[model samples]
Target chain A: MASKIRVKNLYKIFGPHPQQALKMLRSGLSKENLFKKTGHTVGVHNVSFAVQQGEIFVIMGLSGSGKSTLVRCINRLIEPTAGEIYVDEKKITRLPSQELRQLRQKKLAMVFQRFALFPHRTILQNVAYGLEIQGVKKGISENRAQAVLKTVGLKEWSAAYPDQLSGGMQQRVGLARALAVDPDILLMDEPFGALDPLIRKEMQEELMELQEKVHKTIIFITHDLDEALKLGDRIAIMKDGLIDQTGTPEEILIHPATEYVANFVTDVDRSKILRAKNIMIRPTAHVSINDGPRVALRKMKKEALSSIFVLGENRTLCGIVTVERAVEAVKNKETGLQQIVQTDIPTTTPETLIQDLIPVAAAAKVPIAVVNEKKKLLGIIVRVTVLAGLIGGGENNNNVGSSAESGNNVKESARSMDHISDPLPTSITGMG
Target chain B: MYLRSNYRDFFRACSGLIEGAVNNIEALLSFIPITVFILVLVILAWRLSGRGMAVFTLVSLFLLVSMNIWDETIRTLALVLTATFMALLSGVPLGILASRSDLTENILRPILDFMQTMPIFVYLLPAVMFFSIGVVPAVLATVVFSMPPAIRLTNLGIRQVPAEMIEAAASFGSTPLQMLFKIQLPLALPSIMAGINQCIMLSLSMVVIAAMIGAGGLGGIVYRAITRLQIGSGFEGGLGVVIIAIILDRITQSVGKESPEKKAA
Candidate 1:
């Protein structure tokens, strides 16, 4: 996919003589050191990233970390002292003032941390402001603004001023105003930061739901890690005006690229971030449906397991059969495993979060089967693995091994279901 | 000295232009029948400032009529309104300019301070020397005296518009002019209106001082009363001035408070 926005080697130094400060910065002076020496604050330092079309790219940092400055540089609200910014292959930093304004009008819009609705304008008028400034006629612009307001669930408040609305509702108006322009990209600067925790979560979920509908390429700024993890398709972690890491939420959580990133991720609740796929191990033993109850009994005994998964053609999970059932079936002289197989076992998809999987793991008599959308058996999550995944240290290594082992099993199971599946699920017991 | 000697014709031309504007406004005011004018003011006060102000405007203007000082009061009203109008016309744009640039603001601050703090008498001499004793010089001196608040308040109001709001405006691709008119000016309306109210009151006060230069109005009545030691007519003239000041103050004050959108909410 083509990148909707790309920033390269961007630097924004806030002072009269930024060029001189830029030289000192490029020559390896630290942000603090340079500031002390020349009274120049480095707002963004050589930051670079690309946002894919329709991706929610979050820039996460604490206060004064340059995330806001960096996002502003994308639209040249704060002119970058040095760097290249390209949107739709056009160089933003080099665009003349007229073209820049046109670009801002047509391609970019922003939502502020404080819901910055115009106090003097009605909600509809505030929402229509972007289109109004673009010279869209009042009648047409207002119709579209009304539609956008309806989308954000603020249609009733259209005739009211911003102060009449609650903070959450006002932010909905802010979101409506941004969407009213139909810009290809949105620059949100800590949009939910000022809201109470409950409202922030509600807004975050609403934003995700809205994103699913709009699919605009978004550049979200936040100081909250959980928000970043939840909303970001990709996240760039910024520290002291430089990017510490840029990766997907899971990658950042699982393998932080720097000590700063690692420290940052440490306090994050892993139960929310880790998924069934991250924790599931390759099943130790299973017998194809073509095999008889004797084959199931032999496999379970060999693995010293109480139960084993029974697979149909293409490794489709048919059911699980306990050793006692298999033994009883063998004693009854049953030729097929169908009679003995129990299909009522718990199952989950790979994307289910560990927090969501805990109850399913606790209540299951047999290990939970992790299947794909096609119901193809991918792996299983034993009780111990779920516990260990929640406990969360050294589990990253286990996760890596399990995923690698599962990758091999998918091919191996396709080639030969009769062959034993190695790297026992019992190995997870050692973690406890 | 340099202005008087080197720019005599330029000063005379400016004085001529101003005198024409003041006379035109005075004539326009005179064109309105006294009953119609009072009725319009009463209605305006009622709508903007409530019933009490409307009654006050009615009773007070009738008092001026009964005192037989109605024409003088109307002349004073024209002068004050003309001065305020000119001050706003010039001051608002300068304030907008100062708001846009740091250097302009820094340069304007001391100049505004000087204009506001310098005594009325100090500038009256310059006004007489330049425009030479008429409503023109009176209007000019009043504008100078009353203009500072307009500029200073406008600058302060625009500057005080929340930074986030400005960013929001910019992010939506508002041109500089659009930002000023749509966001900054609208948000700054109350402050600008306060500035205007101050300008009107200052212009009213300046009118009496202006009477010393033969700018005829209620100020002339008060000045003549004072020179001749006629306490009765002087009190009547002073009451007329007070009534006009209160009426203007109440109306403009209400204009700032009555933002349509906010009122709707």
Candidate 2:
């Protein structure tokens, strides 16, 4: 797949002689050491990355770690000292002023952290600002702004000035402004970073759902790791203007690329970031609805398992049948596994967070079923798997990067049953 | 001296134009009935400010007329307002330029300091030498004296606008002119108004000193009273000047605070 954005060897220095500073950075001087010695601050040192189309890529770091500087470089809002940035296969770093403006107007939009809605402009005018700058007709721009405002759930606020709205509403107006232009890539610099925790959480969920519908590639910068994990398809952690690591959240949690990343992920609440699909395992033996109760018992016995899940047509999960139920049905001359099957077990989607599954898994008679939208049995989350996911380590190992890639591009996985099938139901212990 | 007397015909031509402006202003203002003039002031004060300020303005102007310096007060107003208008014409653009470039600001700073800090009496000597015993020199001196605040405050206000907001505008690809008009000017309006208010106050202060140069106004009345030692006329003229200052200060201050957007949030 063609990458949506590619940044290569990006270097930014805050003082004169950027070229000399670039040389010093390339020679491996640390940001602090360089600052102390030469008095030139390094913004981003030798940073390079590619964001695939439709990816929510997060760059995370502490304050002054250069995350904001990195995002600005992508759009050339702050000219990089020396580097190249390519967007949509076009080399953008060297684009002429007019061309750069065209790209900003037509393809990319930014939402600021402080809700940079113009105080003088009404909500509708603020939302329509990008279009207005692009020379779109006033009437059309206003109509488009109204529609986008409705998308962000801020209708009836068109005529109100920014001051009349609350912070969250102002933020929505900012988002509406960006979306009104229908830009393909959204550059958000800690957009929800200033919101209260509850509003931040709500905005995170809203952004995720919005992405599901809009399918815009998002570059989100934040200092909050949980928000990064919650929103990022892949997160890049920055330290002292250098990208320490970039990987799936689970990959960072389990196989941290650097000691910095390791220490950073240590505080992350794994239960929330890890999904049921991350820890679930495939049931080795299952009885089909067409098979009799004898077939169910034989399958459970052959696999050395106490229970076997029953699958109907099209891989739809029918239910789980234990040895006792199968044996009793067989003794009574039960015709099929249908009568013996237990469908009372809770079912959850692959995306359900492990924290939400704990109660359901604890109260269940058997393992919880992880099903897809079509009710097809994708995997199973047993009590041990849920417990393992909560206490994350090698036991909770998941190929999240590959699985996510597969999930996004259907042909890559086409029912990627390999996720859970390799590790049978009973073997997933301590994935947490 | 050469321009005023040596070039006799050129001096007459210039002084004649100056006399026409001063005379027209003096006559036009005093020609209105005293009640009508006060009524206009009340209306103007009400429109810009609120009813309270309007009432305050009415009382002050009435005091000017009752104190028997009504014509003299009107004459002073014309001189002060004309000087203020000329100062704004020159000051705002110089301010905008100073705000834009460091070089311009550095150049303007020392000049404005010189204009503002020099004694007001020092200006009268130069005024009397250039356009002896007339209103032309007085208006010119007032413009020089009052123009510095407008320029300095405008520069400060523009520079004080948040750099982030300016960057936000640029990131949207706003042209240089668009950024100035659409962001900087609107945001800097209150400070600009403050600069104008200061200019008006400074011009009014110069009005009395201008009388010594033969520019007649309330300043002339006070000058007469001072020379003759007529204590009664001196007190009334002093009272008239105070009333005029109060009205202008109140009106301009209200205008400076007018922007609802800046005032609200």
Candidate 3:
């Protein structure tokens, strides 16, 4: 993927005589020592990262960690002490003021943490402000703002002032304001930080849903680990004005690169982040599709199991046959196990979240089969595996496929499923 | 003294220019029939403040008319308006400039303090020295005396605009000028209006002091009545000044309150 925004060696020092501080920093002086000695605070220091096109690149850190300062540096809202910034491979750090403004107007927009809707403007007017400042005609800008308002679900509130709306709705107006300009990139500075938890979650889901449609490259900043994990395609953890690690949510969770990152992930709810493929074991005993009922029963008895999955060519899961059904079929002189096989068993993709699989596991009489888009059985996740994954037991599951393949599969299933609300399919009909 | 000695022609030209402006405004006010002017003020008060202020404005102006101080009242109103207008014209932009730059703000702070704290009578000496004891000097003195609040409040208002709000505007790529007009000025409206109200009231008070320098109006009436001890006419002239002060204060204050919503609507 092409990088949408790239910041290299970015540093922002908040005080006069930053050059002296920069010299001290280059000589390996510590942030605290430098601050104590110089009375100059380091906001961001030696930070570097690239945001891929159409991806949510989250920067996670606590307050005073320079996350906000770093984001402001991108749009030149706060001038960086030193750095190079490239958007679409064009160096923006050295652009003149007029060109920088054109860049902001044409390609970038921001959603503020406080919603920052203009108090003197109606929702529609606030949303239209970016366009208006760009000198767009009033009628056209307002019409565009109206459409963006509808997208953020604030259409009816367009006539109301910012103070009249709830915090959530006001942020929706903020989101609409950024979207009104149809910028290619969005710089969101903890956009949900001020919202209550419930509203924040709702906004996160809506942002993801909106991202699916718009596909804008988004750089999201947050202090909340769960929010970063839930929304970030990739996350960079910052500490003391520097990046400690940057990786996928799974990578950050499972194999934290630094002690700080490890401590940060310790409290995360594992079930929500771990996926089905991470826990599923290789199915040991199973029946072939051509197996007779007698053979199936014998296999189940020998494996010390009550039931067994029946497989077709290419290891495709056909169905499951319980020992009782197999035995009954045998006694009735059934030649094949087709009549005995139960095709109405639950199944899930390997990319499905374990939280989504818990209820399916609780209700299923048989182990849930993990399959891919081709419906080829990858592995089987039994009730114990599901429970084990929830309690962080699947950290070293050897049966898991390559991470890249599973990552792509995750994107595919995520697009197909209604996020977080619905469980995986309870009954995927097996190939007869 | 050095400026008066060396720049006499410049001072005379400036005085002439100011005299023209004040006379034009005074003539404009006098040209409007008194009844129509009263009607316009009543309607403006009704729109800006409410019906109660409108009624008060009507009754008070009628009282001024009955007291036979109508022409003096018009003349005073013109001087006060011109002075207030000139004060705002310079003060608002200076305030904006101060808000934008720390150096400018620091430089302006003590200057504004000096302008405000010096007694109103002290400015008359310079005014008369330059413009020679007429409506021109009176108007100039009033502008000087009343201008500090306009500058101070404007600076305060723009500075008081939330930093995040300014960031929001900047993030949208607003130019400095755009940020001033679109965000800072509008958000600062209430404060600016308070400044304007102060300016008008100060101008009224100073215009009376300007009467000692021979500027004629209700102040002249009050000055004459006071010197001769005509208590009834003095009270009448004072009443006219009070009525005008109340009306302008209420109207300007309401403009700030109403404008935000009006713009939103």
Error of 3 at A237 (Å): 2.4
lDDT of residue B188 for candidate 3:
95
What does candidate 1's lDDT look like per residue over A11-63, in tens digits? 99999899999999899998889889999999998998999999999999999
Per-residue lDDT of A1-432 in model 2, one digit per residue for the tens?
Answer: 889999999988998787887788778887778788888998888899999999999999999999999999988889999989999989999888888888887888888999887887788988988888888899999999999999999889888889999898889888888888898899999999899999999999999999999999999999999999989999999998889999998777767888888778776767777787776667666779889988877776675666778899999998888878888998899898767888886899999987788667545656678899999999776555554444445444443222322222122122223443344344334333
> Candidate 2's residue-wise lDDT over B1-265, tens digit each?
6556678687667667756777787788878888888888899889877799899888877777777778788888889888898899999999999999999999989999999999878877866676677898898899999999999989998998888677677667676787798888888888999999899989988877888888888888888989999998888877878878878887788777777634364
Candidate 2 falls in which docking quality class? acceptable
lDDT of 1 at A237: 100
TM-score of 3: 0.85
In model 3, the Cα lDDT at residue B143 comes to 89
Model 3 chain A: weakest 10-residue lDDT segment is: A423-432
For residues B48-121, could you state the per-residue lDDT of candidate 3 as single tens digits? 88899999999999999998999899889888988999999999889888888999999999988888898877
Q: Global lDDT of each model?
A: 0.87, 0.82, 0.86
The better candidate by TM-score, 2 or 3, is 3
Give the candidate order by descending DockQ: 1, 3, 2
> Quick one: best TM-score, which candidate?
1
User: How would you order the candidates by lDDT, starting with the best?
Assistant: 1, 3, 2
lDDT of 1 by residue, B59-102 (tens): 99999999999989988988998899999999998988998899
